[model samples]
Structures are given as C-alpha cells and as structure tokens.
Target: MRKILATHPLHPRATAMLAGAGRLAVASALDPKTLTTEARDADIVIVRAPLPPELFQGAANLRAAIRHGAGLDMIPVEAATAAGVLVANVPAVNARSVAEHVMFAALALLRRFRVMDRDLRAKGWLAGREHANSTSELAGKTIGIVGLGAVGQAVGHIAAHGFDLNVVATTRSLRPAPERVGFLSIDALVEQSDVIVLCCPLTAETRGLISRERIARMKPGALLINVSRGPVVDDEALIEALREGRIGGAALDVFSVQPLPPNHPYFGFDNVIVTPHMAGITEESMMRMGVGAAGEALLVLAGKLPVNLRNPEVIEHYRRRFPAGD
Candidate 1:
C-alpha cells in the first residue's frame, strides 16, 4: 500500500476515505524536523501546517502535496515542482466561514463585547450596561475590503446586503466590479472607510501593505479588521496606533508569530480582539476542506492529476517520476 501523511488530523470522514486508499499516518508533531522525518516515505502529503522546502529533498516516493485549505503559503510550490511533486489545494471552501468570522469580530469590537462580558462577570450587570453607551451599529457604515477574492467578496456581500452598509474594495484582478460594490484605490479605501478589512493574500507587494504611514491616513476612530496573513500589517505600528488611540480598534485573526507570545502587547489592549488563526475553521468548512484534500490524494494515487492542481508546469516531471501503466 502507498503511504500517505497528513500534517494534522482530518475530519473523520476524510480520515476513513484516505485509510481505505492508502496507509495513512497523521503527524504526531508539527515541527519541521518531525514532519520531514515522518514524510520521507509518503507518496502523498495533506498539508495543514507549513512544509519546509527541505522536506522535498529526500522524499523520493512523494508524488503530491495537497493543501487542506486555500492558502498556498504553507507549501513551497517551487520546491515541490523542482522535486517532481504536484501541488493542489481546495480553494474557497471556507470563504463563508471566514467571512462570518470577519462579521463576528467586527460586531464584537464595535459592541465592546469582550470588555462588557468581563465587567459583567467581575463587577455587576450595571457595569455591563454602561458599555452600551460606547457601542456602534453596523448600519450605514462604509466598509472597505482589500483584495476582492472569494473571502473579500463574501465579506462585501454580507456588509452590503445583510447590514445595509456601503462597500468599496481594492483588487489586483482586472475583472469588473460586482454590483453595489465600488472599486477604489488602496489609499482611497483606507482613507474613506469606517471599517477596513484586509483579505489580501501575503505576497511581495502586500508585505507591510498596511504600514505606519497608512495607519496615519486612517480616519480617527476607524476600525481595522485583518483576516489575512499576519505580516501584512506592521505589528508594532498597529500597537503604537492603539496605544495613542489613533484608530478606534482592530480585530486580528492571524499574527506574525503563532500562539502569539505569552503576555503579548496586543492582549493588553481592550480595543484589540485577537484570535488564534481560526477564521476559516467551522465544523462544516473543516469537513469540506478535509474531503476536498482527501479526494485529491486519491486521484494522485490513481495516477491522475487533481482537479484543483496549483502547479501544472510540474506535470512533465511528475509523469516521469511516476510513469503510467507501471
């Protein structure tokens, strides 16, 4: 039986499906060294965590690296292609889940949910009631979305249709703007928005896209919501802004460091809402991602390319490595 390695546990349904197709092994630990050792003999790898490029060096039997979700950042595509490995991913499977999370974070920050809940438990009902004075509603607010990808589009839909808010966006795509959504330059979007949402992918152009200078451009008391990769925003710049109360508040799901260091400065700010990179995780989305990843694995095992193949240029090398009719 061919060996399959999963960086983390999949939904039970996906687990059973892969088990029937190959010898499935879930990683015990996520460190680079541990994953490298565990994946050396794997024919297929379902990636959830970052896969070091060096893992491809000695993985002779590896034919594919399948991402459990949309982001390709976790898998080094260049390294995989160089090693004759196919890279595939389940894209947009969790767009709704992440969009919902963005709304949740926005509501939590605008309503002062965390502080109110804390004070209610520690002090009394009246203390919690006092927080209502500072709360704001979503109606009639102008929301600016960075990147009009699946997640961004979903967020715009909810903001415009569900909350009766105005939606504007910036995107690298050449496509026409969606109805009720106006396209704007990044600078304009940042300046005019009441709520700025970052849904762009992490790339050379986007690294530090929301810099200290841009933070200065934001309207005073404007809210920031980042569901994108961590490094897109300057952590120190944001903290400085929050300290001076330059902006209203922020909701951050991804961070520059995983498990954000204990006693991190962000935790000290009541206006900042921090989450453990779980914006795309929901029971429904998990199953969809898992099943999608597993289906790709099974296709590769059957000597076929995945439907969502991310690296088509690697096909010649892959075919040579695993010749057909063998």
Candidate 2:
C-alpha cells in the first residue's frame, strides 16, 4: 500500500476515511518537528499547518502534497514546484463559511455589539446610550472587497442581495462581477467604502498590500474586516490606526501571528474583534475539505493529475524525472 502522511490530525470524519483508505498515517500533533520524522518516507504529505521548506528535504518519497483547504501560503508552493512535487488545494469549498464569518464580524463591529455586550454584563444596562451615534446600520453602506475571488464574490453577493449594501470590488480580473457590482481602482475603493473587506489570498506581490499609507486614506470611522491571510495587512500599522481612531473598528479572523500573544495590542483595543484564524473553519466546511483533500491525494498517488493542481508545470518536470515509459 502507498503511504500517505497527514501532517496534522484531521477531523474525525477524515480519520474514518483514512481507515478506509488503508494506507494513511497521521502525526500525533501538528508540530513541524514531528512531521519531519513522520513523513520521511511517505509518498504524499497532506498539510494544513504551516511548514518551512526544510521539511520537504526530509521527504525522499514525497510525490505530491495536498493542502486541506485553499491558500498555499503555508506550504511553500514555489519550493514544492521547483522540486517537481505536485501541489493541490481545494478552493471554493469554504467560501460560504468564510463569507458568513466575514458578515458576522462586520455586523458585530459595525453595531458595536461586543462593547455593548461587555457594558451590559458589567452594569446590567447600557452604560451609555449616547454611544448610539457611533453604532450604525449595515444597509446603504458601501462595502469594498479587495479581491474578487470565490470568497469575495460570495461576500459581494450576500452584501448586495441580503443587506442591500452597495458593493464595489477591485481585482486583477478585467471581468466584472455582474452589472450591479462596480469595479473600482484599489485607491478609489478604499477611499469610498464605508466598510473595507479583504478576501484576497496572500502572495509575494500582495504581502503588506494594505499599508499604513493606504490605511490613512480610508473614510474616517470606516470599518475594516479581514478574512484573508494575516501578512496581507501590516499589523503594526493596524495597531496605530486603531489607536488613533483613523478607522472606527476592525474584525480580524487572521493575524500576523497565530495564537496572538496575550500582550498583543489588538487584544486590548475595544474596537477590534480578534478570532483565532477560524474564518473558514466550520463543521460543514471541514468535512467538505477533508473529502476533497483525500480525493486529490488518491488521484496523485495513482499517477494521474489531480484537479486544482496549483503548479501544473510540476507535471512536465515529473514526467521528465520519472519518464513516461518507466
């Protein structure tokens, strides 16, 4: 049986599928040190956790990698492609879950729900009704989406139809998103939006895309929501913006660092809502990703190309190394 190594433990349902696959192995935990040992001779590495390029060096038999979800930021995609290893990710499976979380955060921040909840719990009533001026409705507000990927499109759809909010988006795609949604220049969208939502992926060009200078251009009291990777926004700049009230509030599901240190300034801010990178983490989403990843792994192991093969050029290199006749 071909050996399949899972870098981290998956959902219990995926565990069940592994048993059925009959050739699966899982590390006891998600630490990279453990993976280096567990995956040394494995034919495939299924990764959900961040790992450095060094880990790939130890895998002599690794023919392919399957990312449990979208986003290849954690997997060193370029290195894997150079090494002739097929890398695959399941995109769009988590779009609805992530879009829902974005809406949840946007509503919470827009309405000042967390602050009011804290006050009510402490004083038995709203300590100050006067703060209503700061709390606002979601309707009629313009929401600017930074990237028009699956998650961005999903968010735009909901924002437009469900809330009747004006939707504007910026992306590399020249293709517009239906007639009602307007495509704006990034600068124009950031300045005009009442709420700016980031649903983009992190890439070399996109790192620190939302810089301090851009933050300064936002409408005063504009809400910021990021469901994308952390490095897309400069964290120190974000703290400064929040501290000075350049922006009214932010809801972030991803951060520059995971398990944000207790002393992180974002934790102390009254206007920020921070979650532990769970924008795409839902029970339903997890199951779909698990099944999709497993399917990709199976196809790669059979010497056939998997759907969503991120670096398709890897196939040409693989064929050269292994030779089609062999």
- What TM-score against the true fold does each predicted structure earn? 0.99, 0.94
Summarize candidate 1's per-residue lDDT along 193-214 as a digit string, tens digits: 9999999999999999999999
Best by lDDT: 1
Task: Give me the runs in candidate 1 sitting further than 4 Å from their true place.
Answer: none
> After superposition on all CA atoms, what RMSD does each candidate show versus the true structure?
0.8, 2.0
Candidate 2 lDDT over 186-299, as tens digits, reads 889989999999998888777898988888899999988999889999888888999998888899888888878889899899899999988999999999999888888777
lDDT of 1: 0.94
What pairs collide in candidate 2?
none
Deviation (Å) of 244 in candidate 1 = 0.2
Off by over 4 Å in 2: 128-133, 320-326
